[model samples]
Target: MSDLKLTRRQSLVLGAGALFALGTRGAFSQDATTLTFWSVRLNTPELQAALLPILAQFEAEHPGIKVVNEPVSGNLVYPKFLTAVQGQLMPDVAEAYSYHPLQFAALGQMAEMDDLIKSWETSGRLKDVVNEFAYKKFFWNDHYWGVPYNLDPRAIYYRKDLLEAKGIKPPTNWDEFQAAAIALNDPANGVYGLSFPAGNFHITQHFFMGFMFQAGGSILDKDGNLVFGTTARDANIRALTYLTDFATKHKVTPEGIGSWDTPDAHTFFQQGRAAFGMGTGVLIGEIQRGNPDLIDKIGILETLQGPAAKLTAGFFNPMFVWNYSPAKEAAMTFVDWFTQPGRLEPLYAANPGGLWPIFKSEFDSELTRSQPLMQEMLAKVIPYTTDFAYPGTGVPEMGVIDGEKMFAAPVNEVVIGQKTPAQAIDDAQAKMAALWEE
Candidate 1:
């Protein structure tokens, strides 16, 4: 099939027209339900090939439903989704980052899956298979709004040979982490102890949040209220101070890390310029392609422990049913079928690490157990993993804050030594409060 290309503006216009036509035509056909699926992952060749076949299989089994697959560019997905929501032209099934559906759920734009999920025969099995952390992140207002799709868990990737050669053991806590970093630093040899991104990007936000969580604090409270400036101030400051100190005080990370993005840090590790780096499993693939020799020397560890907790960041892009869609039942059917281990294993195999399973059954399957690396990675992450918004405080506006980089700017200021960690945290909290008020 030829690609269905639609610019952002054109998508909005066409979406609105489609809504009008649907309304004027009255109810959909009685015999067949045609469900439109909008997904950003389809932009990739591997994902497209893996998903298209599964969708076709779904159509074959359920002859009464037709699936219309639409691929949207990652950068344009949120904006176009907003436009569709405003125009009442939402797709029947849509893929979204965890926070995106929360935004829609707040507005009652997302369909609640609690009833459907509970009534399904596989509900008990699903609960058993899926990591509670993975599914719970989608819970809001006491209802499940999204189906867990994939997991991206962050861990520390270190040079096994370098550490062994230095007679240094892997770090488990902050002090040991710092000591190891300092010991591993060799500026004359063009090696840094650690590599991290400090730019105003998603990577920066992610790692920063992991640090904050490890420090036993979060930007928002469990009640979804802004707490960074008041209740969580000290913990937030401590986390930020520790991160900035890597460059400003410890001097173990690269000199210009305050301006580096994800690629910069990843490249530093890939080229053997850094002994330790923090990232998702995808980094393994990039290393295999760019520095194949380093593959055997790489070792993974859970994020280091802090005074209060040991935590790391995990990301999920979920599949949700839009409330405005006429084929909500059909969309749920597809989601239910898609998440089953039998159907999902192939998709996971097509893109290892990139689509880590959220289900325990899948985790225990031969497909996962066959690869010890994947198994070890999952074991290290699942227990301590959390979403970007922290665990229980994912409010609608958090999505807006993340998208606009409201949290990143202040963090960047601290990293560059333009502001103290305390000051930056206070400023970020104030800015976030304004957003919540608005």
Candidate 2:
């Protein structure tokens, strides 16, 4: 593996270099056609047990092809991939964040998948495909570059037992959510209303974007222009004010949230220190590992409504074949096989509430039916889910905007009282615009 530590300037330089790298002609194993795959699932016994067997089956069915699953952490996927690109050591296939394929595609490092998808549609296999939002995440520059692996929507997870004890129903909209958090918040007893990151991390950006969308504001309009501080200024201001109020005015979240990231928020929630936590189904798996007893007491809510709209950021972390792969057809075959319901169900069951199905019909599968909680979550989240490129198809600059912490900085400023929401938004807009102007 390549060294994971690289500066943002280095990453950009490597990204530009990827456009010139030639393809590797053969598999890492000379004896067989092996597909080197990078998976986002952590390298754990349970995940391996669920994933390896499916690869074995694919190998058995194909007779001459082998699939290797290399587990990588979610945060490191993009950087490691960029390193691979710079070295011309790209994997045959890899899973990445929802925004990454577009970046890779724009750099000419990712293979276009339109033909393979068309083949599936022609063969009537497209019915099992994920919904439009998931598919659209990888669609940019008039081509499809990735396949949706799972649906990652920003849903709320609350302490069911705690809410019940307080005689509160699960909140559905922003007002109800804030009220519930305030009413149940007891800082003296080490219980707060909400647990979410406000740090200079992508998790913070995700949360901030969700609120902005819920308030009917978008980062870019349909023409791919920055609008947060222009056309959608008021909605973004409202969104920022509400988000910071949790830490400043409402005083419901834990102290020093501006310094907290995903792990901090996860630990705070797992210890039963908060009444509400915001994340994807991944939170369920985290709680199950850190505090199994809390599992039965947890309730997942749909993306809450705001004054302007009912919307949340949906992440369709997709799998894409590197353009440098010699065996493109073989890689797609494995990609298609691994995403089938039968193969996906075992992985889902093994993780137990961690992975949500990208295919809409899988919600009614026996696996989902057996787990009542998953069924409830999918039903609610699907309706409110929108891609990070809301109100537009998607743009390559969107990845840069997210990677550079352009959105989180503004929210951090407002929360820390260094600037008003309007000032923060304006400064962020100026900084972001300056990036593309170069």
lDDT winner: 2
What TM-score does model 1 achieve against the real structure?
0.89
Question: In model 2, which runs have C-alpha deviations exceeding 4 angstroms?
Answer: 1-20, 28-32, 42-45, 123-130
lDDT of 1 by residue, 7-80 (tens): 33333222222222121111258789888888775457777888898889999999999888888897897778
- List lDDT for all candidates, in order: 0.74, 0.77
- What C-alpha lDDT, on a 0 to 100 scale, does residue 145 get in candidate 2? 89
Query: How would you encode candidate 2's per-residue C-alpha lDDT over 173-221 as one tens digit per residue?
Result: 9899989999999989889999888888877888888899989898888
Q: Tell how far residue 157 is off in model 2, in angstroms.
A: 1.8
For model 2, the run of ten residues with the poorest summed lDDT = 1-10
**Error in Å for residue 371 of model 2:** 3.2
